[model samples]
Target: MFKKFSPSTDISGQTPVKSSMQRAIRSSILSSWNIDAETLEAIWPKKESIIHVKCREHISIYTLHNEPLFFQHFDGPVYPTLRLLHKYPFILPHVGIDRGAIRFLLAGANMMCPGLTSKGGRLPPQDAALPAGTPVAIDAEGKEFAVGIGLTTIGTEEMKKINKDVAVESVTYVGDELWAVQKL
Candidate 1:
């Protein structure tokens, strides 16, 4: 099941990160998601670097890369815990969303889902992978923005109970309240 997170749970505290390292992390995240360098750089910017959870659970951020396409496969880290998915790979978020609600929506499904908690665009039907409650925003042209991350239940039916019509089995609640204006 997708677990929830809160501010008090921030184990990393507000530690500052180096710019070169930030660039590397952004590149890694883009590569893992198979986003091209050009697009990723456009959406996210090199100067914008910071990582934090919107709610206790969701990972919210804007990236140096603008590939909203990457968010369709929202399989980075499931929850906003101190733990990293090194078992698979690790790529820290650069610009995080500021609101919990947007975080919840992104955590729940890709931009493709209808009726997002906030009104943004949608993603394509490519093999998108949802982690849990990850919320994403799409541009008018259908690109994606990794607005916030999500927590999910293991089974699809269970997720539907929390949010009906949501295709993925994971249920998403908004992680950050300010994510709408920031990312979208």
Candidate 2:
């Protein structure tokens, strides 16, 4: 995966986030990721300065102290920042994949059912109950690092019934343009 990630050249201008926008961001994060308000407040203190950049046509990336924290898509829910993933590893619903799948994921491939059903891969117990299109963190099995974010294509029960089809569509993963853009 690391081999496939070339640094991005796209430049995005930063703008100070307003108080009303901050409140909306906080609310969206809480509802989308199921995090409590207090924890969200603690992670994003009111006094600290935060800014946002339009990284893509529809996506705006939020940063605090020059570190990317989260991003919001105009038509979708908020997405966890890779930085936040390291700080709060289990905050979002997740699927575990073996090391073999990491490279492909970083290369922008969708996750197949076997990656979640293989000996080294596993799905969260509650994932079977989640609706399609729910955001899910993708973590490596033994390393326990978040490698990607995806949206489930089907409910967990359906995922289990199939063996070779795509289970989750990759939205962003480590080493992709979103991650590389932060380095710019």
Candidate 3:
């Protein structure tokens, strides 16, 4: 399920997002991740401004104090940035993968089912009931770091039955443009 990805060069239209819009975004994060309002407040203090960045036709990125926080897709849920993942890995559901699959995922490959069902992989029992398209963090075996965020292609029961197919579609990873965009 991996595809070759080329980075984008356009940064043409960026402006400060409104407070009203920021509130909606905050609400979306709270409800989607099951996080409390206080936690959200702490992560995103009132002093920081949330910027709306249009990277392309359907891709919009939100940044807090100039650090990328989420990428909103026109047709999907907003995905937390890798910076957010590194700071708060437990904030999202997790899917563990074997060490061998780490390189592929970093290269923007969609996570294969076998990687999650293999010997070194483990999926939490609580995540078994989560619906497809739920955002999740990816962790490699024996590593304390989260590699990226992905959308589930199937629920756990179906995932357990399959040996080959795309399990998680990579939205953003360590080396993707979303990650690199942070430095600019």
Best by TM-score: 3
Q: Write the per-residue lDDT of candidate 3 for residues 1-184, one digit (tens) a residue.
A: 1132223455556799888888888788888985777777888876687888776557777777777677777857878788887887778888899988999898888999899989988776754566788898999999988888899988765777876899898888777766766643
Greater lDDT among 2 and 3 belongs to: 3
Q: How would the candidate models be sorted by TM-score, starting from the highest? A: 3, 2, 1
Off by over 4 Å in 2: 1-9, 126-128, 181-184
The sequence of per-residue lDDT tens digits that candidate 1 reaches over residues 1-184 is 2233333453224333467756755666565443467655554555666542232233443222221112212335323211122111223221122233344444544322333322442322224433443322222223233433333322223332343344333322233332222222
Candidate 2 lDDT over 80-166, as tens digits, reads 767577678767887888778888887899999888878778786753466788888888878767888888888776777777789
Candidate 1: Cα lDDT at 69: 16
The segments of candidate 1 whose C-alpha lies over 4 angstroms from its true place after superposition are 1-15, 51-184
Error of 1 at 100 (Å): 24
What's every prediction's RMSD, in angstroms? 11.2, 3.0, 2.6
The most accurate candidate by lDDT is: 3
Q: Model 3: which residue pairs collide?
A: none
Listed in order, each prediction's TM-score against the native is 0.33, 0.84, 0.89
TM-score of 1: 0.33
Clashing pairs in 2: none
